[model samples]
Structures are given as structure tokens and as C-alpha cells.
Target: MTTDENLGKAAIFDLDGTLLDSMGVWDQIDAAFLAKRGITVPDDYMETVTAMQFREIARYTIDRFDLDDTEDGLMAEWDRMAHDAYTSIVQPKAHALDYLRYLKATGARLAVATTMPAGLRAPALGHAGMLDLFDAIVGVDDVGRGKEHPDIYLEAAARVGVPAHAATVFEDLLAGVQSAAGAGMHVWGVYDESSAQSWPAIQSIAQGVLDDFAQAPRPLA
Candidate 1:
């Protein structure tokens, strides 16, 4: 058992760039999807769409490309490609699995609140051998509202049977941090070299920031 497991507190993780390095998977998926439709978007399209729900991205793609297909069709194609890329190339973020294991061993209740669909979240976590680490795995559809809204975080906290205020959220995006903060959870900002330079808002909201899971210095409150 690890110290974290004994905390009697819940910690929620955001999956994409936060718990796993799957943002690039989404980028590749989006590129492929747009390419198939003979459409192209800005170079930083992925950055622009970070933390967006599928429905939201679909609307963006439709508006940007003026596609022939219905929104459902476009979403299907994108989701299929994303699932493929996630299975083949996406990887857990550095130290993410180990940190989850430590949290489990130490008796903390761990959960995932992500924009990813439940179908994808399961296999990805299973592949990383971290699926069982979570007491709850909530996806975008499980909540009343999406990212940038507190509903998902609130739902995750509820899933763990904890009040939102007692949970700690680990996230990489500003919007997600804001959502969790609004849900009244303590927040931890996880950073990469790329995001580190532009995380002022997250820095302001986070109780603390860490480069990776190995650097999670504080015990759960």
C-alpha cells in the first residue's frame, strides 16, 4: 500500500493530454478525417480544439469545411479514426500509470473524468493496465454538460461518493481546470514543456503544479 491510498480522498484525472499523451492521437485522427473529406484546417487546429467534445468538434468541422455529410456521419468517421489511433499509437503520459498505482496502493479513490467516450477510455486504460485503478471512469456523455462546465467534474465526484469539494482534480487544460475549480475541487496542474510556457490561468487556479506524476509532492487532503 502507498501513502496516497490512505488519504480517504478522491482524485479525478482528465485523460487526454493529462493522464495520457493522446492529444497527438486526436490531431492525427482529425487530420485524417479532414483529409478524407478533401478539407484542411489551420495548422493549430488540434490546439484550438483541445478539450472539446466530439459534438463540438463536429460542429467546428462542419462550419470550417462545409461538408456534405451530416454531423453524425462526420462524428462517426472521426471517432473511428480516433479509436484506431488511440489503440495503435497513443501512450500513457509519463509516470501516469505508476502514479495511479501508487495512489491505489495508498488507498486513495481514483477516477477519470474525460471528454473521451466510454468505449475508448476503457480500452486505453486497460491497455495501460490502469483501468482497475479507478473507482469510476466517466466520459463526456455521462455528464449533463461537457468540458469547461462543472457538470462532468461534479458527476465524477459523485461517482466516487465524495462531495465535489473534497475531490482533487488533475488536469492539463485551462478550461478543464476551471471546470474542476468551479466544481469546488482542489486542482493540480500537470505540465509538459509545451504547455508550461502558457499555463498562467491554470497556475492561478491550481493548488500546485507538477511536471509529471513523479513530482506530485503533496499528500491528498
Candidate 2:
């Protein structure tokens, strides 16, 4: 449970598995990309790159599989493969819209802090009717670091005109929860099937854990 004192004045949300039920799209992309090169997706590959940014993932894939592809080439291919799904097939996580509306009605500033690239995020959020709901969308490209660092979360709070301690971050991954908490913001862990292995760590770090956004405490009037 998140007490009123911990609710904060701004809400920073993670995109993929947190607010958008879209991790499965990435799984399909990984498998298909590897399959195209006559390689099977390694069982541990997705886990290893779970918290990485697009460029990082590209570099890792090229090196790990001894592929002859440049990072830029791989990234472009990935963006092409996943763009349509992000813009059309992806949907909000259970009750995510309701919670966003609840926070909006509370007069709390809202922002997105995600590792997703801007090319994918913009259309996806726009199609989902969420683009205008946020005060800002801070992507991994903006910070040049992954969620293991507090850069993205800190910037999101700053952009939303909230102190780090006066913001709450809703995240679905252990790395994201740690990043926001490391930035001195309150963290609320959202459950995602893709992150099941890291659930215990997320529970231990977050101020609250939610299987669904509907379970979130109502914003204070």
C-alpha cells in the first residue's frame, strides 16, 4: 500500500510492460529477427537485454551472435518490424487508463519515463490516446543510459516540474523500480508476465506492488 505521504505530486510511468501490455510484441520481434538470420532466439537472450536500450540491444545481438550487421542496420530493421504493432496492436495494461485519469483528476503532473525509442513511442502513445495525457515523455535516447541509472527518472521528474522526492514512479521491471528509488522517488511496482522472474526483487524495492492498476489507491483530493 502507498500511504498518502508517499503518493507524491507527480506520477512517472514506464511504458512497455508497465502501462502498455506490449512486452509480447518484443518477444515476437526478437524471435522473428533471429529467425530471419537462420538463428534461433537464445533462451536467455531476452532476459539479458530486458533492461537495455535499443542501441545496446543491437550491439549485444551483433556481438553475441557474431552477426555481420551494423548496430544502425539492426536497429532500423527492428524499428520496421515492430512499428506497426506498437502503433496499432498494443493496448494499455489492465485499468491503466482509469488510473491515468484518476491521477489527472487529482491535478498531479504525469510523465512517461521509458527505454523505448521516440520513433516507436510517439505513434504508439498517440494511437492509444495517451500522447497528450503526459506532460513529457523521456526516452532512453534522451539520457543515453538504461534503467540501472537514475538519469531518465530524474529527468522525467524535472520535466514535470516536480522534485524527485515529490514524484512517484510506476514501473514493471526491477531495474526501473531501482532507478526511480535510487533517484529518491517513491516506486510502485506493476506486475507483468514478462518480468515474473524479477518479481521478488521488485516487491522488495517498491513502496507498493500492484497486479493491476485498478488496485492502486485513489489519489487524495
Best prediction by TM-score: 2
Across 136-179, the per-residue lDDT of candidate 2 in tens digits comes to 99987798988888899999989988898888899998988887
User: lDDT per residue, candidate 1, 79-154, as tens digits?
Assistant: 6777766776778888888888777777778889898866688888877678888999887777645677888888
Q: What is candidate 1's TM-score against the reference?
A: 0.90
lDDT of 2: 0.87
- Per-model TM-score, in order, reads 0.90, 0.93
> What root-mean-square deviation over C-alphas does model 1 reach?
2.1
| lDDT at 4, model 2 | 41
- Using lDDT as the measure, the top candidate is 2
Error of 2 at 38 (Å): 1.5
As a whole number from 0 to 100, the lDDT of residue 63 in candidate 1 is: 82
